[model samples]
Target: MLALLGACAPRPQGLMRPVVAAEATEQGRSVDLLVATNRQVVADPDVRYGNRRDPHLHLTAVSVAMPKGRPEGTVQWPRTTPPQPQTDFHVTRLQTLTTVAQGRGWMRQHRRGGHVLLFVHGYNTTYGEAVYRFAQITADSGVEAAPVLFTWPSSGSLLGYNYDRESTLFSRTALEQTLRLLANDPSINQITILAHSMGSFLAMEALRQMSIRSGPLNPKIQNVILASPDIDIQVFARQFTEIVGPRPRFTIFVAQDDRALLLSRLIAGRVDRVGDINPAEEPYVSGLARAGIVAIDLTRIDDTGGSHHSRFADSPEIVQIIGRRLAEGQQLTTSDIERGGFVMVAAGALHTVGAVVTAPVAVLEAGSRPVPDISGTLAADPDALRTER
Candidate 1:
């Protein structure tokens, strides 16, 4: 487990430096990104933000350029300084917003269709990792919203799991502040949260705080998408229950084959993680269906790098589905998935499995039809079920 986690750690330093040359500007695609983080600032321009906590929120506007014809869901990180943007993901520009008011004003002026997609990254991810990953997703998914990222102080070490988790707790209020600011903004029509792994825990806690303090979440805060959440199942249940009023629509992307969550579960005293649970099983199927949550099982889909935990953004089919359907605050239909065609390890075929009360199914046989009865869920529409208030 240590080796697995350590393998993904970025270089010790210097990947965040801005590349001044515009060689890739003409040929490569560029993505404008808005970053919100609680990471302490450092003097090194080569590595501006370090893994240290900050009491206040820091906002930065960045533009990452990707090489031409880069495939969906892939981030080609620069191998060396003065990155070749044609073959790597390079930061072309970086500007820091001195105040929260300035950040809000920037959003007001630049937001597209009043939509903002906010991403919260998972454990062991560095600042550069989170930035590049969001840029790749924004460029690949073709999501129409303004791309926003909320990064916390992560220790970025294999053995720093405890520190990383605690960092989330420390950074909770900052994130809540960011969320509240966005929620109250009249120009921002909707806020979509896409949190991965342990980041999902942070996102949930932020919403829970908002629910307890501000009454109900603002109606504009629409969808909360969790990708391979590393949250303890019971903790998640309580968090969801405590949020006492109207909340955002929740969609979970789960995979039984997620090795990262499997390791996380082992460290968590064998308690099942929300991400790796069998949604068709007793507690989860009933609880999720009861809560009106949509869980997309990607166990059979596979092929999401070594960890397989980032299947949501690493898989072209899955990412496209998110961009084309889920980003629009729309639920995915069987046909929507059929056109994208998930890359299943078993026979590599198209499958359809949609139910009234959404339940997790591993795969659908080719040419299959929706069978709500056998799916162990009884419902009329996935969007009809409201979260427990």
Candidate 2:
């Protein structure tokens, strides 16, 4: 029934939504986004977009405009003749960054506090999907920082997992170049990476390469939010340690019930995927805490849209929490953590923090009588934690 409903849902008419400038009298919000992609450019005049690896890197500047009176957390695609005239929700001001110097110049011109939020989409995503997802995330987050999307060539097909993995690996050098350019630019202050699913693998590998070739990561990297990362535990540990210099604060969002990652785990020889690690289990929680990794369990949250896989962007509450923290240039706050019904496993702490709504606030102190597993109990009885909005 759910699959039927999903199949029956309305999809945007066109996958490639170019920008359309709004009229002077129109009341709406516009976000100027910088896009960096390694996808091959498709010459189809009907849909001017990029396809999986044309074996070239392209940089583009786009203006995403939300139509007036449009509901929050929604992007509507306007259907028209040329696809770039007065439309409901449109992206305009598309210009290519022909060279690395040009890309750096554009970044310098638009950077805010040297802060850039770079988003890397996960598996089975096309250039259009990545661009639209980043645009939606930027709009919903309400962050003033410059939004950048690093799109690798994902085969964009469900059965293309092997192809996507290879493509992600193939684009590491290009992604590394993009990151190096941003890091070297004096005008860029900090970069917050939000990588989802397989993209997290690419992001980590690029960082690893940068650290190996260059010295340590540039201090410009402030925070890294790994949303439902589809990575192996052992591989992630190696990448984490290989990163030289001051480590960026890492916040990982995980859900044991994430079906996508469940499939990923099966495909990867049944090894535990980092995103689905059960924090209640020993060694994993302790290891994550000792490594200074902040893990937030979203299994109990009921607000996720579509699937359990994308709660990071799908859930309004989660999105707001992430946006607020990133916008303030800080880690997850006590209030933010608690409000999201999230349990934080801080470094050197054995027990998790935060009280679910409608439940008594309790602290699970280390060495205290077999600490009641907060995430486990909540996962078992999520209804009790849900609060009426």
Candidate 3:
């Protein structure tokens, strides 16, 4: 188990699908996506087209088709020759945007006055990994919003932690620019920021910089979701304070037994990572409530594989909930929790299974209801339902 966990570290790789001309295939429906990155072009003809360091940001449009059957929980990538019809991502078109105006114009045309979901990847991730992950996420979530990937340069090596952190810091200005461009555009109605692991640190730092330079965040950014964040609790509090305005609906997904973050904590001089917070604890719950943050504790939820750091994306039930809520532009209320059955509502805050419910609670969302049937959404492997924490 430990070996498997350690091997789960992310690394740079070639694009899952090669860039090709736009043409429909028998495999599935094609999804046109817009991507922005700061990685330098490697001048390689292969799928992995970029390297770790680039001074300027670049924009491109890509098309990712869903597998014919539209698999329920995961995005199926083609691995065989002539590619299976039901599962493959065909990179139909790729267009580079030379200027900010061109990028904004492309966004305006593609967005069609709809919402946009911006994804930021985590540590040891490469350009291709980030792009494909967002594609899978968008497809699995069933969100109508335009999908956008904001990729920063990461060394894509397990031992490149310091380099990745430096790269994240270096990319904040570019990320902030991208966000501002989307927020200020009249063609985009809303923007949702979904960040994971160390990416959350970069996302928060960029937002803090924006707040510091331009007052509060733009109103168009309606939601911010942080999953398995690799950030120090103290640093998170400081970053949280920098944003001074009516905050967006901030939601955080935490798991107490996240082994990746356990290692991160040790590396950070024993400081607690935000994603490993114990929501059942009074101080943590109260602090989240005071910050107007909704905390979802997934400690009791079983992970499908790996170190369980990416459980937010691995679990079908959680993915469905996320997709449904994002599509509806609804926050995860106490009622939603009861309906999902993945987690129990204690007091007002969402808690892991077996936590005692109390009165005068710090509820994450509004409303209350009786538990509903979640059998359909539960994982097939009963053993997978049992959590280490």
Candidate 4:
């Protein structure tokens, strides 16, 4: 009878068009819908691993409907707009699930009383990269709010520098608009942003523009973290001076040995912005005249030769600090800021501290080289590696 009734009902239209199939999982969720015209999924719904190696955006219908009675779950609502040829795209249900858990966690926490944590990925990141990074962040940050990722179309190719730059330019306006909307929404209590590499440019540009356009930032924003920002130091100073004015609560995480950024320097005719450190360059943050910037130095640590990338995801200490700050709203001290040791650095003073690297107890011996431990719980696990002693 239920099957006959489902067949008799009018077929749904557009992206939300529904189809019937045996329930996929008794313990899992299921979704069935159409893809907008031009948008595509970069992976096969069945094949999960190779999707990252060479993604194929599939223009098909996908939806996720969670089992009822859960505190928080997914629902496959009909999509409104048709797919456009240019840039609007969507991921498959299988792919999205692999990444949606973090966001759902955020939603659950927000319902209880938590803030939002937004992620912006750097130059060569794919959709999957953004999702996995957020998962790691939510798991590590200890923040309960929703995790939203702003994914610009990055080709994720080392040689696609120009293409990535173009995508950044094209996507800037949209990204800023989204930020503004989130800020103005009264229901939102707090917001924190963690941008990595090239994504730092986008994050800074948005803040600068918003500050210039609007007098001061929404008081709801707490932290503006830049991990391995790829912008020129002097340029950042000048821009912040004009836009933010003084006393901006920003944290810049820098490492002297960022190889990927080193490659970026070569491509830019050997520029210093590729993991170069100059703490004094932007001593004072804009909007706040006082020196409120937090500069963490990853120079002295073993860093596994390419330790710059480990700041956000790998180091247990850093993760613990940020997690405490976001979850508890702890205030840091000036001395602590200078040391950059804990979650709450000293407010009102600039901090320049050296990060402590904890070596793994077990080391693996490779043929010719010692493998660095890279097995931390977060996305970019530096300690999880089976390194040689």
Best by lDDT: 1
Model 4: lDDT equals 0.47
RMSD over all Cα atoms, model 1 = 10.0
| Tens digits of lDDT, candidate 2, 1-389 | 23522442343445454544546545377777888887777776333555467445678887766666666555555555434444456655567777767777788788877788899999977666677678878888876677888988888767788999998888877777667667767778888889999999999888876665544677788788889999988788877776765778788888777888877888899998888876656677566666677777777666435457887887665676677675447876556544533333222122332321111111122221221211111111113222223
RMSD of each: 10.0, 12.7, 12.2, 18.5
lDDT tens readout by residue for model 4, 144-185: 555556666777565567777666655555455445444544
Better of 3 and 4 by TM-score: 3
Q: Candidate 3 lDDT, tens digit per residue, 1-389?
A: 34555573233233544544344455466667778787877765334445467656678887665656765555455465333444555455567777667766777777734788899999977776676677777777777687888988888766778898898898887787678767766788888899999999999999877766556677888888899999988788877776656767787888888888887888899998889977667667566667777777777666666677887777666766676684346777665555644343232224342232111123233122332222111121222222232
The TM-score values for the models, in the order shown, are 0.86, 0.80, 0.81, 0.58
- Candidate 4 lDDT at 74 equals 16
The 10 consecutive residues of candidate 3 with the worst lDDT sum are 372-381
CA shift of 100, model 3, Å: 2.8
The Cα local distance difference test for each model comes to 0.76, 0.68, 0.69, 0.47
The residue pairs that clash in candidate 2, if any, are 19-91, 19-92, 40-54, 114-189
